[model samples]
Structure formats: C-alpha cells, structure tokens
Target: MKRIYLSLSLLLLVIIGSRAANFKFAFLTDIHITAGDSIPYNDLARSVNQINDTPGIEFAIVSGDITNIGDRQSMEVVKSLLDRLNVEYHIIPGNHETKWSESGVTDFARVFGSERFKFEHDGILFMGVNSGPIIRMADGHVAPQDIDWIKTELDKAGKEKPVIFITHYPLQPGDVDNWYDVTDAIRPYNIRLVMGGHYHKYMQLEYDGIPGILCRSNLRAKEKTGGYSLCEVTPDSIFIYEHKIGNVPTRKGAYSMTGMNYPKSNAGYPRPDYSVNKEFPQVSEQWLVRSGYEIFSSPAYWDKKVYVGDDSGAISCYSATDGRKQWSFKSDMRIIGTPAADKNVVVFGSADMNIYGLNASDGRLLWKINTEAPVLGAVTIRNGIAYIGGSDHKFRAIDIKSGTVVWSYDGVEGYIETKPLVYDNLVIFGAWDKNLYALDKKTGKEVWKWHEGKPGRFYSAAAVWPVAANGKVFIADPERVLTAIDASTGKTVWRTKESMVRETVGLSEDKRRIYSKTMNDSVVCYSTTTDFPEKIWASNVGFGYEHAPSMPVEKEGVVFGSTKNGLMFGLDAHTGKVLWKHKVGNSLISTLVPLSKNKCLFTATGGEIGLLVIDYKINKHK
Candidate 1:
C-alpha cells in the first residue's frame, strides 16, 4: 500500500509538470540611461517594441543598471521607456545606480519600487535581489535582508518547484563580498537558473552548482547598437536566445542549461584558513574571556562594565576588573558593530535588521526596534535618542525610551554603515554614495553636504568615525586621503597627502596630532597644527590580506595598533617610534580599548583567542 502511494505521488507530479505550458520572457540589462543628450532612450525603445511584438514573450526582467547615474531624471527616463512594453517587468539595482547618484539606492527604489522584488508566473517562482555593497561602492554585497528574504521565498516554493534568481552583480568568489553567503542561503532549494548583469556581455557559467547567465548591455559607445536576450523556461530545462536589434532582427546565439562544474561536497570554494599554528606572545594582562565565535566589535566601557558583540550574535557584558562574564544577550544574526552604553542602558544593531536595547548591568532586553534592512553600525546615542543608518538606505533617530522612530532621513544615495557624529545641533555622517552629510538633529533635515571626488572618494562605508575638534571635522576615506572640513560652514579646510587609509584615525588630546594606519602596512603620525596636515613620522608595521582597519587607540603619549596577522605595536605618540611589539594570536581586527592612561585591552578574532588586557604603565616608559 505504501509503495503504491509513493508511486502515485511521483505520477501526479509528472502529470502536473507535463500539463504546464512552456513560458518565455525577455531578459534586458544594463540600459545605462544617462541625463539630457546622452540617453539610451532610442535603444531601449527599440527593444521594447521588439519585445512587445514578439509572440510567446510573457514578461521582462531588467537585471539592474537601468540608469547610468541613478539620478531621478535618468531613472524617470528609463521608467517611461520601459512602461511602453506590453509585458509586465521587474528591476533590480546595480553599482552604477548606487555609486553615481547623490541619493544612492533610494533614488532607484523610489523610481522602480524596490531594489528587490519577486513574482510568480505560470507556477514558476522568479526572484530578483540587488547585490550591491552600496555603502562601499567598490565591491558587491547582497544585503542580509535580501538574503533572508530569498530563503523565506524559497521555503514557500518547496523543494520540487524551480526558482530563478536575478541580480546585477556576478556571484563569484572575488566578484562579490558575500557570494558564498547567497549560494549557501538557497542551496537547499531547487534553484534552476541565476541571471546577472554588469559584465556588459553574454556569458554562461557554472557557479556553486547553479547555471549563471550574464547579459549584455543595451547600448554601445559609438554605434547605434543594442540587444536583448530571450529565455525559454521548461519544467526540465532552460534555453537562452540572444537577439540583436538593428535594421532587422539578428540572432546572436543560443545555449542549453549546463550542470554544475564544481564538487557538491565543497559547495563553491573551500573556506580560507585564518588561523595560525604559532604560539602567541605572553603579555601581562588582567583577565581574559573567550566567546563561542569571533569578535569584530570594539569594547564599550562604562562604570566598570565592558560591553561587546561577537560573530555568534551575542552581546555580552564583562567585568572590567577581572574579565568575568556578567550577562549576555543574543540576536538572531551576527553583531557586526560595537555597542553604545549610557545611563544604565546598552543599545546596538545586528545583521538581523533589528536594533536592541538592554539593561547595562543585567543584560535584560529592554526593547528592540525592527528596521527595513540590516543595521551594520553602532548606534549614536544623544539626549535619549539613538541614531543609526541601516542597509535600507535610511538614517533614523529612534526614541530610546519607547523604541519608536523619531525622524528618519533617506536622502543619501547609498547605505549608512557609520556612526552619526553629533556635533552642535547637526548630525554628521558619511555614506557609500561618496558624500558626507550634515542634518538637523531634531527634525532630520539636511543642513549641508560635502562630496569627496577625484583624488579621494569616501568609499569606506562609514567605518571611519569623524573626529570633531578645533572647529573642524577630520576623517580618512578608503581612498587613502584625510580631509578636514569646517564644522560651521561645511567647507573643505585641507586634505592630507594621498595614501592607503582604510580605518579610523587617532587624535591626541591637544588635537594637534593625528595618527593613521596605511594600506602599505605602516603606521604614520601627522601634525594637524600646520596649514595642511603633514606626515610627522612613519613606522613600518607589516600586515596581511585579512588586516582590518587596525584603528589605533591613544593614551598617555603612546599609540597602540594591531595587524590582522596577530602582531600588536605600541608606538611613541609623538616620535612614531615603535616602543614594543607582541603577537596576540590570530587576526587582530577589533579596536583597542583603553582602560586607563596606561593599561588597555586588545581583542583578537578569527579563532579561539578572544580578549587580552595589558598594562603598559606609562610611568616606567617616561
């Protein structure tokens, strides 16, 4: 009886699949429409007409880069042109939209509904997600929310239904930040095809057991050239056909779906080993505590309580005196940023797209406010309000007392991954859109904005916090230049020599000296008292590929920094001479926390070793 039931279920699936009609759609990408005279309106119009007249074409999917700059006018032009198409369509976001637009992904979303959208046609599941590290602008990263959403949608579709995923960026190991993350999220589901743009040419690839097809752009530089691809989806297999739009319709090529090229046991690629087998250097410390996962966040100290978050989605409080675990709070996802503590309350954001508040002493959950996307930065608390920017492209000020939004500013073109610098009555922060913004703190209105162009772009995605001192705001961008802007007037005061500055800079108490870590594996000191900041001294400190920002912390005329390869350095603050060096263990990415004028704590990540507290007594050195 059981054998008969199983056979019947298989027969029923085959019957349903056989009765399902074959569906076809047009896949267009990289329109790259710009403003004014340089628009691709005619090219897109031709494609629209062709797709409309073509028989059996059910719908269209534009795999990102609809506009060249993601400006409102450009996006509006693309929208109007696409609206002429008789079939329904969907769109995602591309790097061009997130990079060139002043309002980043927000402008694209306003014009096209969202960077992520999904639909069902003829019992087939089709999904589109924006794989944009809009905050960095240099690489691609599918936002955590989008990843989760894809998983949820796949769950709804079940194992037997085929899914087609679309994005603007290629999901290869080096091409995107979290390529394996997306692959891992949907590996359990029956994903049939993955479509991508950004290569500007048609190519088929086998990535992590999925068939990935990249499409060509709709425009050419000097010629009136444009093209679109037709995809035919069946229950068993998929076929792709390319069409070139010219005086007459021309066939480019056709391809049948291919099987996975890599091994199924390893997924995409083998994970890199970040651990070293050597023993760590012994240093005098107070106490140590190890968490179950890696720690990337700097510790927040207040009234003898230390707060920090880890990769395992835990926010734990430790006793500053003896490093005892006092209390802990867990989230559903990783805690990528540090925690902010004040007045018996601790607040932080997580990759789960939720902002959590807890009791500082007891670790009891006070409130949690959910955002539209993942929150990747620490909250900036001022006057009982928590200010944060989320992957949703909105910077919001939430009331700490009630965990409700007070005001939100969604003006920037990129994601907000930085701590808002509250200066005077303004909230100052940077975004992936290469712009620094200042807004009214109370009402969330724009005050002024500054753009980092040409020699340097602020592509660090708000990782570097602005140092507000001496009537100026100083910060280093990922492009290796430091700039000072007048806080009152929002004008450029001066810019330092270009170098590789990918982390937060350190400042002296007198506000005359600035310290920075360079991409060349060197730590340098600069004099801010001069008209243009001048490099005072530099010390060669080797680093590795995993080397984090190593944001140097200062105390009692000494500066301390660490490299990803487990080397730590204590340098003379003024002379830039290395005082001492020590090996902690594995990757040392988190910022050093100063315990006093002399003693401090260094936390290493990537493996088992968690926290180390050292006492560098200044009296002995002086």
Candidate 2:
C-alpha cells in the first residue's frame, strides 16, 4: 500500500508539470501592415511562425494595429497569415482599426473576430478589453455583456488562479487622466499580468501589484532591430523578453548642421522668394539650400539621409544635418502636407487637390493626379497605389507609379483636416463639417461616415491619431469633443465633451497617464476610467491661436504645447501645473517638438523657433 501511494504521488507531480506554468506568451504590436509600411506582412508572418516554433511559449497576442488601413481585406490578409501560423492567439483592437467610425465595438466581431475575447489556458484566465480610440477609432467600452462576462470569468477562476488581461492601450499608476483605459474593469480582478501595445517603443511597469508589458510594433521592431516578443510566466512572476532583427531606433527630423554655431537663430528673417525659391539669410548663398518643413507629417530618414515635404508642396532631400540641398521636386501647388517615404518612393498630397508620387532619392516627381480640391491631408500608400483625400470632396487611390486614378470617392466633401489614418485598406479622417469619414484605400468606396450627427458626435477640431488597437481611430473636433470611430464604418462608440479643446495636438497615452494637447492653453486630466477628467491647470500660451487656447506638448503627464504668444509652456504631464516657460519673445506658430526619449517638451515659437527641452518633476513618489 505504501508503494502504491508513492507511485500515485509521482503521477501527480507529472500532471502538475504539464499544467500551465504561468509563463508569458509572445507579444507583437504596431505591425503597421499597410501597403508601404516599413515592414511587410510576409515578414511578420514568418516571424509569427518562428515565434510559435519557439519552445515553452504556448500562445501569443498582438496588442493592435494588425493592419495599417483597417480594411476588411487587410484583416483578411492578416487572418489568412494567422490561420497558417501554428499557435493559439488572441488580440485587442488598436486605434488604426477604426478611425472614421464612431462605434468600434462591432469591429472585433467583424474584422478581428471580436473586441473582447477570453480563454483559459494552464489554469490562468486571459481577458481582453478595448478602450477604443478617439480619432479614426471608435471608443470601446467593456460591453455590458463583456463586463458581466469578466466578472463571471473571474468567479470561475475563484481565487485559485491569477488572471491576465490583454489590450491595446496602456494603463499606468498615479499618472494623468487614465480613466479612459481599462483601469476600472481590471481593478477588481486578481490580475497577475497585463499586456498592451500601440506605442512603437518598449516599456514595462507594475499596476496595483499586476505586472504590465508594453510590446513594440513588429514594423517598429524591424526598424529598431528584429521583431516579436516571447514572455515566460511562472506562478510567481512574468518575464518578457524582446526579440528583434535590429534594435537601432530611427530618429525623427534632421539635426542642425548649419555652421553658424551654438544655439543659433537666423540672424535675419529668411525672405523666402517662393517665385525664385531663394532665401536671403546668413551664410550659405546658393540656389536655395535644402529646406525642410514642419508640417503635420513626420519626415522619414534612412542611412543618414533625410527627405521631408513642406506646406509649400515641395519634397526636399537635405544632407540631414548640414541642411545642404540635395534635390527638390517642387509641385505647382502648396505642399504643406506629410509624405510616406519608402526605400525609393515618397507618396504625398498637395493643396492643389492632387496626389504625387516622387522618387525618394533625387526628389524626382514621377506622377501627380488632381482631385481638384485642396488636398489638405497626406496621402497613404499601400500595395502599389496611393490613397489621398482632398477638400475637393474626394478620396482617391492612384497608381503610385502611373499617377492614374485607380479608384475615387466623390460622395462627401469637407475640409480633410488630418492625414488619412489607415488600417488595412480602410482609411479614416475628420473633415471641417464635423464629419468623420472612412473610405476604401483601394477602391475609394464610402465604407461609412459619422451620420449620427449630434452635438455629441460633432468633431469640430479633432486631430486624427493612428489606430490605438486593431480597429480604432481617435479624432477631436472643434466642438471640444473627442470621439472614437470604427475604421470599417463610421459609427459612434463613445464621445467625450471637452468644450475646451478648440484645437487638438498629439495623441498620447501610456499605462498610467494619458495626455492631449489642445488650443485651450491647458492640459486636462482624467485620473482613471471611473474618474472624471479635470483641467489640471492652464497657462498663457499661443499668439496665433485663433482656433483654440494654446496647444501643449505632452508625454508622461507633462505638456509643452505652444501659446499664441510665441511661447512654449511646460506643464506637469500629470497635474497640469506649470513647470517652466521658455520665451523667445516671439509667437511660436510651431506646435511641439520632441528632443529625446525622456524629453520632447522642446518647442519652437514662430519668432524664435528656438528649441526648448523640458525636464518634468512629477510629485507622486515625493
């Protein structure tokens, strides 16, 4: 009998070993699967396959941004790839998934299979909740059913096992208004781990004793090093490790190389002769030295060389630092727009209501297609076609090489104030008419628009942010309202009224704190999902801020938006209190500029345009 009992005990040990070890699953984020993203879909597929092949990782999860355009086809492509990969996986929708539609709840069911999904593996329960997005994304809430289900799921676990949550947005502790995140719902659960992605960078933290992981985008992973993450979990702890091809991060903008020396300003105003393309300033006298514009779009840089577009409709390649002119393709119209730079092609739009495809190297204009209205936003490139929107009341998909219109949408007309936020082939943006639109990047079909039209959904001045999760888009309108839209169809999910948001700046959210810059000359704080948002404080900002109060810069509860006074105000990213004010004694029409990983509060006012870096002092720890 004793021998029999020993054998039974040995069998029990084997069974426990085979059970879940509380190890981490692989996490991949910001895949950016649009047509011309830095990384391709096939590459990600191979990486996924390889990750599944890795030993000990039982499952995987993607935080969001599975596709760039948020189109049905993009999801189909991604699903097809996932179908072939040998792994059990779950996901959360990011902002890119639904930028145009206000309602993003159905997207998880239609495009990604579901917005909130869960399963039990190895005695641990995993749940996913989407907060949705404010721009081209639909704000997501834990559906009444999902909320009930989470309670049920937790009850099923019964304190015997710790739960894990998967999501696209981050949630940090003691930060700015983070109420829009999963803080409320997840607070009650015995959560051991939480995972999220959306940011291109990698970060980590602990929230209320629960460890959280911020995954990087696959495309961003490739840009930095390799791609993908494999997390190993034990009953006691979770270990997440980054796997990438290269980890070198690409920097934004060109460094100053103009020789006039340290902390220099243009001695005299650059008298720009647009007719002659000449600037009369100190030093270099040549046929217009290479000029860079700080429009809405981020300039792409590769191999120490840089290319950027300006509001004047010029694609200029500069010598990165020296500001030496390499070549420029000057279009016939103003190009105060953004461009998508690939290895060889630069795709963008112009105010002439045209989409232009140019050679990336020499700035050679290869093709241009006119839509006839002011193309206020940047064009999106996927596959071999370029998708663009214009005030001409049209969205066009043009052959990148031929400049021929592949498809076009003429159904809606509004001022396309923001660049098209693409997820898959679905593109989303807001117009001046307070309408958010979603169009086919391939066929230019009107998938949907925000027709719910009410004071609640009216987005007067919302800036479009990339997808937060799979099918979410964030936009703030002039009406001081923030709305989340579904990328596939324009629908209302959740709308926040911030009558103070006259003009919108950037999209910023982390695990604990969330920050947005507006023309209000102030930054507001919503402490948690259940807490009300409060304007932490205000400042004297903006000189030309006829639109709103003053745009502030933000990261980690600190802001540095500009005022019409040509001044940059630094406020606590958390408390919204003034930290420092950099004054060049001139109006800074320029918005906000980031300088480094821990900094970016640097701002340029119009008169001085001098860079001011901010150092924040958050008081929570103190």
Candidate 3:
C-alpha cells in the first residue's frame, strides 16, 4: 500500500564536485525490481534519471541485488531498464540474485560483469564482489582467492592514488563476509574509500582507519522518501548526497519495553559511574497540566501532522500547529525508536520485540510481528518487510502485512542498540558485543561483519553517512570516541583518538562533511580525508552541562544540543564558537530534536521536557 506524499524537496540531487576534476562517479544499490513491479521499477527509473540530472559524473555504480528473483528473465529486465540510465553502470550481484543456482553468480558475472568488471576509473581502483558466491548456495564460498588479486592489482598501482573498493558484500559484518581474507589483504594499501551494497539502506562507518560508504538503493529505502546516495571522490576526501524522492507523512507511537528492570545478563548492567538519579516532577507550577506524555522520539511531520513516539508504548498522531492528539495507538511495548511513516501505514518497532504496522487514518494496529529480540531502535522497511535490530542480538525482517517473520540473523550475541538499515539488499546495525553486522535481506544469511578490535561496548546505533559524495561509517564506542570505518571491509579509515572524546552519538552529517560531538564538553566536525584526522573545528560549549552534552545536531551552519544541567546551546557549525545558549529547568540526556528550522525539543532528568523555539532564520540559512 502506498500513500500520496506532499513532496517537499526537489528530486534533483545536490552535489559539489572537486575543483581539480579529482571527483569520481556516484553509486546506488538494492534497487529491487521483480520484473513486473511497476512501482519499484518506476522509482528506480525516475531515480536514475534524476541522478543523470546532476553532472561531472564519471560513472555509475550499483552495489548489488538489481533483480528480486535473480531469474534470467528478471536480470534481463533490470539490465535493459538500467541501460536507459544514459550513464556507465557498474554492477554487483546480491544474495537475492544468487539464490537460484550454484553457478547463479557466474551467470550474473557473465551478464553484468561484462560491464561490472573492476577497474581504476579516474585514478581510483574499484572492485566488485557478488553478494553470494558466484558458484552455488551451500557451496557458496566468499571468494578468498580474490584477496590476493586485489593486492596484486594495487601493488601494480600507485600507493599515492586514493583507491576505492566497491562490492556487494562489505568486509564488515552487518555487511558482506566470507571475504575477510580478501579485506585483510587490502588493509595495508592506501585505499581511502570502500563502497558496497546488498544492505539497501544507507550507512557510513570508520573502523580501523578505513572509511566505507554503503549506499541506499533506488528501489526501497526506509526513509521519509525512497532515495539514492550521491558520492563525489577527490584524491583526499569523499562527499555524499542524500537525494530524497518525496515527502511521506509518519505516525507517532510508543517505543518502550512492556516489562521493567530491563533485560538481564551482565553484558550491559549499568556501572555505578554510569548511574544517575532521576526525579519525577512535582505537582507545583513546575509541572505542566498535560497528563499525556510528550512525544520524545523524532517526529516525522507529514500532511500537516506530527507523528512521534513516546514512553507509553503508543503511537500518537498530532496536529503540527498544536499539540492536540489526532490519534493514538497502544502497542505491547515501548517505542524508543523513530517510526518510518508514509500516508498509508506508519511503521515502527517496540520493546515487545515486535514491529507494528498501523493504519495512518486511525491508530488501529493492522499487524504486529515479533522479532528475535527486544527492539529499542527503530524499523527501516524496504519492499514489504521491516528490518529491525534489537536486544535479542538479532537483525530481523518481518512481513509488513501479515506480521510474520521472514528472515533474521542471530550470528552475534548482544543487544541491538541501533536500528537495522536496509539499503539495496543489505542489513546494517551495531551491537553491544562490539561488532557491526551486515547480512543478506532476502535469505537472512550472514554477509560480513565489521569488527573494530572489540571497542569494548556500544549503545549508540551506527549511522550510514551518504554514499558517493564523502562516504564513510561513523561509529561511537562507550569510552566516548567516534571513528569512521571503511564500509566495504570492516576496517578503520581513521580514528578520532580517545583524547578527542568523552562520549558519543556516532556521526551526523550533511553532503559536505561529518558533524561529530563528544561528551568531553565539546563538538567537533571532520571530513573524510587522505591526510587523515582533519578537524575542521572544535568548540568548548561546556557551560552549565549537568552531564556530558547529548549528541550534537548539525543544522544549517549551527550545531545544537543541550546538557544535563538543563542548559541548551547552539554553536557555529563551522567556527565552533558559541552561537546561543539558554536554560530550562530540566537536565537533558537526549540529543537535540529539531521540529523545524527554528524549533527543537529536549528532555531532562529533573522531569522536564520542553519544546524550545529559537530564532535561526539567519543562522539556519548559513
């Protein structure tokens, strides 16, 4: 079911090329076309056409899973359709396209590889890996033999040139796997960028000093709109573009656990230092008369309404102009994550370990299916099912309509603090066990896992920076440091060093650069680089913070967030100079939530949550 959208941003992508012609091509992945599905096919066609709308383009790359069924007929259909793109297309096969035969990938390799073959375009070497073994299913071996070939090719190539690796599988888990030997082989190279697909959603990570970008596909992207990632590569840095298709409205719901005391296991029992005292508000004038909980999760504003989630485990739809509730739906558990909504049904996950598909018109629950674990993170749905990561230490896909479990990976044992993102055909998420996992969306099999020397543990979900432009994954560890990982192989592209952080929310960004804020009482910005760890600027916004400041927000030219001491701050996004500061009575733990260009929301420990209005007309424009 689809809903009409009030399209906001134009379909055109905004990309900035390198001044030296060092910029290379852009890519997309997981455009699932089942031959006959006109919706997805039209979306893909329109997306490619839009991509062509932007230029300086060297070539086009697709990570994998071009076809839904991997049938000879379907492959032909996708190829013929993609052929109309009016640009050079590089291809990779995902697990879905390789599910048919042992030599299924060989067929894809024969058909798509004629054009998809690895090569150095614009002085950067690009390699392609099929999502599954090109041979067969059970006999499907992730090609270890290819590792030496990449090394040999690079050895023959110049080390000074920035090498970009592309494939369907990521060298990282929550990516593509069986290619660790291949990934380990290329680690010593000066490869600056790694790109992959199969996980249809967008992701960027920095692990072990390697930077990787996983793009969101043309087919099914679980965002406000179905979109594609645009990337630009210079000899030094990569820039990314998050091109949106249209604006779809969302619904509000509660994302919380039904039971108390949280999950057991010594894995994440709060330490004495991590504990804090929380106080409920008094009945005095300090308390608002409203008995209903204010929606806390990020709100998807659509159709003149605000759809957000709260702690009560319910979905609430409210008029954007006022706080009046339009509708509310109660689920079995808490809704701690954001709900992805369109006009028809709002989709979200709950601590009940279930994803609820609710009707947008009313708060009626159409379907509710259980995942492998308790979900604290949101749900990203592509095609028909929703991909979710949870405390169950599993990344799962559930049928959107019938609420049935379609597929899942239980390979790691840890709580899923991050949402499972599906780009083209890949599923990406991080765990408390110190691993980022990528898997095949079609069959629930392991693709690859990105591990960063067990960075202890993490709760902040991983964010996939836009692919192409400046692609990289930003990861945050419990010790409060953030780093970018090469998305292709789970290797570190660069590290922020422990000396630079106190806590983290991972990486947030625009197409131009990355915005990272640490708990060390400061916010810092960095761009993907070859010279390494380039700090654009750092600001000390350490005034009146109760705890380490929550994750920073990058909006316009200002980075905003509040502190535990009930103080709010806005800093120059570039200069790191303090732009604005105000105080409310609450101590904030959550990151700054933006309502519009001028408004933001924050919650504090003194039992205070306020929606603050600001004058950013000038600052937001920068």
TM-score of each: 0.64, 0.43, 0.47
Candidate 3 wrong stretches, greater than 4 Å: 1-296, 381-385, 398-406, 421-425, 440-445, 453-469, 502-509, 529-531, 543-550, 601-610, 617-622
Q: Please report the TM-score between candidate 1 and the true structure.
A: 0.64
TM-score between model 2 and native: 0.43
For residues 552-591, what per-residue lDDT tens digits would candidate 3 score against the true structure? 6666666776554445677766577875666654223355
Error of 3 at 34 (Å): 49
Give the per-residue Cα lDDT of candidate 1 at 313: 81
Residue-level lDDT of model 1, residues 1-622, one tens digit each, is 9999999999999888765668899999999887674548878888898898888999999988887756678889889989998988999888887544444245576688877888988777889987764522234656555677888888988966667889888887545645776888877766777898898887887566666889878776466667788888765567777767754444443433334423445443644332321222223445666564556567778788888887568888888878788888999766766678878889898877788989898998889988876677667888888888876678888877677889989886666666678988888888766788888999999988886645323354356767676777778876667888888888988876665666467777677888878776678777766657677888775553322555787888778777654566678888877665656543444667766545676665542223444444432443
Each model's lDDT comes to 0.72, 0.53, 0.56
Q: What digit string (tens of lDDT, one per residue) describes model 2 on residues 1-622?
A: 9999999999998888777444556777777675544356755876776776666677778777777645455666777776765777887767666343212123345666766678887777778865443222112222233445667777777754667687676654212112222444555546666777766766665443345667767763335344777666664455666666433223211111112111112223222122211111111111122132222233445444455555345666755445465787876554544566664777777655567777877777787666665565655566776666665676677776777887777775454545566676677666656566777666677778774335432344434433323344555555656555555555555557763454454444452333444543445543223223434433443322233223344555555555433344456665555555444422223445443323332212111212233333332232
Cα error, residue 65 of model 3, in Å, equals 47
